[model samples]
Target: MAYLIGILITIIILLLGYIGVIEMQIRSMSEQLERRLKAHTRQNISVQLVSKNLNQLVICINKCLKAEENLRLKSMQEEKQFKEMIANISHDLRTPLTAIQGYQQLLEKGELSEEQRKRLAVARKHSEELKGLIDHFFEYAYLLNTQPEIKLKRINLTGLVTDCLIASITSFEEANKPLEFEETAPVYVEADEEMVTRIVQNLIRNSVEHSEGTIKVEVLSNKEGILRFINPVREPEKIDIQRLFERFYSGDEARSRMGGLGLSIVKLLAEQMKGNVTAEIKGDLLEIKVTLPLAQ
Candidate 1:
């Protein structure tokens, strides 16, 4: 009976070994299949990502091409408008100038008596006025397109303003308008002196042109550490204050003949020197203010 029990135990141990071998083979095959499926999924995901990026790049390129085409069309339209303007300017000026030249020649030839020559002189004066207007147009247009090269340095505002107003005093002498200089203490600023002078000149001219009778100039400092010069306008219009900075805004049709770019040039120069110019129309006074950075 003992011999029979030993043989049965050996048979059971052999069966267990065979079962373990079959289980290990099944696990190996399952691992290999999983790895192949993972690689296939990863490759598909990479290809999809590449395709999406390609679509986005294609859209960006299309937008850039369309923008280039639109800009070209706009440039052509502006060129056409400029040519038409030049033609119109020539016609407006040539007609009056030609008439004046013909009348002057008749007077010079002694074809007209003294009294008739005096009448022709009136025509000549009107023609000269028209010619001056045309010349002003050319100058203002040139200034608009070409910039004056700036040489920057410290500019003394106290002396500059005093001198400018003194030079312009005779211009307003008839009106008995006195220039009220508020502050005379030397206020120095760091900027192009020539440009600043031009700015001040234009401001003074505008004040004398538009201001009632009295022109007051101030170089005052506020809590914000900004220095400004203020001028009053003579006649305030119903037009918006912002419109004064625009080109070709005339204060009066009879008094003003130029394209009204005096203030506009002042505005352009002020901006170039890291300054800002603005205007306000009170009930009757038009106030212009220019703010410039103070030199440390």
Candidate 2:
């Protein structure tokens, strides 16, 4: 009876020993599998387990590895296709659009009656709008498909905002619109100057087109660095705040006149610079806010 008890105890010890060895092997395999997946290597995780339970775990892990590999391959293929489509749109479409603009300019130079000249001017206007639309499409496509190189530096927020506002003032003046800028203390942020310039330009363009009354630009130093554009609109209900930043989303008939890439580009560029943008509508006021990380 004692001998049989000893034999049973030895079998139990061996069984526990086998489980410990299997656990160690599984831990090592898991670490190796993680490294391979992170390196994006085309390698399957394999394990040799004598026990049934461990073998089942190995099978589950292998299935996950296969699924991960398939997802990675599919993402690569989709990205490649997107780039090719953008290339085709840029080359094939823009070339002819450029030619059309050139001919339109040449036609403007020729002599014509007053009515004909006015009609030609309208044609020229629409042509210019079309050109802008095409450019917007190209820019949106590029921003979507590729990561733009951003040169980060300490930018003077007050100075940058002032310059962008000044550049846009002429357009507002020509439209017989009153534009206001409330000066703020100089604040700095880490940002790419060119990209920030684009962000400001797009925001101002949207205001020039849609804003009705006083257009105000201000820089606020708060929890985050904020550049705000406040403008008065005729009716606030016409604007869809939620969909304003979405690509090709024009909330109203007036906004539909635009190519609808302005706000989308602003959002993309802002995020790349470690910033974000938001819009608020209160009463007839439409305020667009761009917030950036303050320079440390």
Candidate 3:
């Protein structure tokens, strides 16, 4: 009986040891799985920094993929819409051009009175306006499709502002809008020359077209490089300030048909040049501030 009890005790000891070994193996496998998962996350694109992060990482990635598919679909729809818009615009333009040609033929063949010639000139001017509208449409479309390449250089901000002002005079005159610029020292910063110029010009035009009161452009040296565009609002603006960079967004309902690529293109170019854009309202003034990193 003592031998039997001893054999039983031996068997119990062996069972405990076997159990311990199994548990250890399980623990090692768990640690290995964790390590591999972390490594895989580091290599993958879909991983997001969530605190409950591991579990949700896969979910976030899936969501991102879904969102990307949606965006591609949306872009496809926009392409189709643009094609229709172009066809309609082309048809509208041809009507005016045809009228101008008919009038020109009549003027050339007959002794038209002064009044008739004047009316023909007016018709020609309206036809030119139609052409101008088409040209503007093409400009926006081109800017939308073009990829920006930033060429960094040290530029004089004040001088750039001066040049932009000079270019805008004629544009403002045609729009029956007055433009004013406030200046400061020649602040130097690193940016793409062409892009900066375009940004300033667009902002100026947008402000002029949308503002009810006088427009003010102030170039001040702030942290790095800052350009501020300010204008007094006549009508309260309904636009979400956060959405100012969206394409075809305009504050005034009446001006919506002017159909601009101005702010949208400016935003894109600014980002490509490693700059930032933001807008705000102070009292009756609508202010847009753009900041760029200074040249080392």
Candidate 4:
């Protein structure tokens, strides 16, 4: 009886030791997986112990990792190809557009009947609009392909917005949209000057082009500098607020010419400057807000 009891005790001890070894191996594998994922490495999780079950688990995990890595590489390649295609298309369109504009300028210099002059004026206007569209596409592609050099500095938000509005006054008048803005106290933010200027200009242009009624602008400062643009739209229900910043997503046929690249550019530039942009519909009004870090 004593010998039998001793053997039973030894078997229990061995069983517990086996379980402990399996637990440690699992923990090591967990750590290896974490390291591999964080470092984005091609290294596979390896096992130290000789267990069939654990080896199978490692194999499955390695297979999953390989699949994920392949998907990531494929996505990156596709995006590069898409950007290159856009750049090429924009470049190709610009050459012919430039020649057309040059010919239009020559036509403008020559004499013409009243009706011909009117038709020429209309052609010039549409050609200018087409040129603007092409330029937006080219700029969008350039922005995606290269990282812009940002020079961060303290900027007067109120003054910058005011300047942009003043510069865009003629456009607003031409669109017959009344502009409304109440001057507030000076607000300051830390951002890239050129980027912020572009953001403001793009927002203003968007409002001028799309607003059905009055266009309003406001600037406020708290923890961050807030620049807000409010405008009335004819059909708020048709606007997809969520996809407003998506590349090439236009909410309406009128906006199709630019392909929604203007707001997309604004969003990208704002994010690059450690800022953010949001849009929402308030009743009949569409409000777009841009927030940037306040100056210290």
Which candidate tops lDDT? 4
Worst 10 residues of 1 by lDDT: 41-50
- Which residue runs does candidate 1 get wrong by more than 4 Å? 1-135, 222-237, 254-256
Higher-TM-score candidate of 1 and 2: 2
> Candidate 2 lDDT, tens digit per residue, 14-65?
9999888888888878788888868967676667667677678877878987
Error of 3 at 263 (Å): 1.1
Which pairs, if any, clash in model 4? none
- The digit string of per-residue lDDT tens for model 3 on 224-289 reads 798888877765557668877776677665446555456776777788788888989887788888
List the candidates' TM-scores in order: 0.60, 0.74, 0.62, 0.92
lDDT values of the candidates? 0.65, 0.84, 0.72, 0.92
Q: What is every candidate's alpha-carbon RMSD to the true fold?
A: 17.2, 4.0, 8.3, 2.0
Q: List the residue pairs that clash in candidate 2.
A: none
Which rank order by lDDT, best down to worst? 4, 2, 3, 1
Instruction: Judge candidate 1 against the unseen true structure and give its global Cα lDDT, from 0 to 1.
Output: 0.65
Structure candidate 3, residue pairs in collision: none
Report how far residue 285 has shifted in candidate 2, in Å.
4.3
Q: Give the TM-score of candidate 4.
A: 0.92
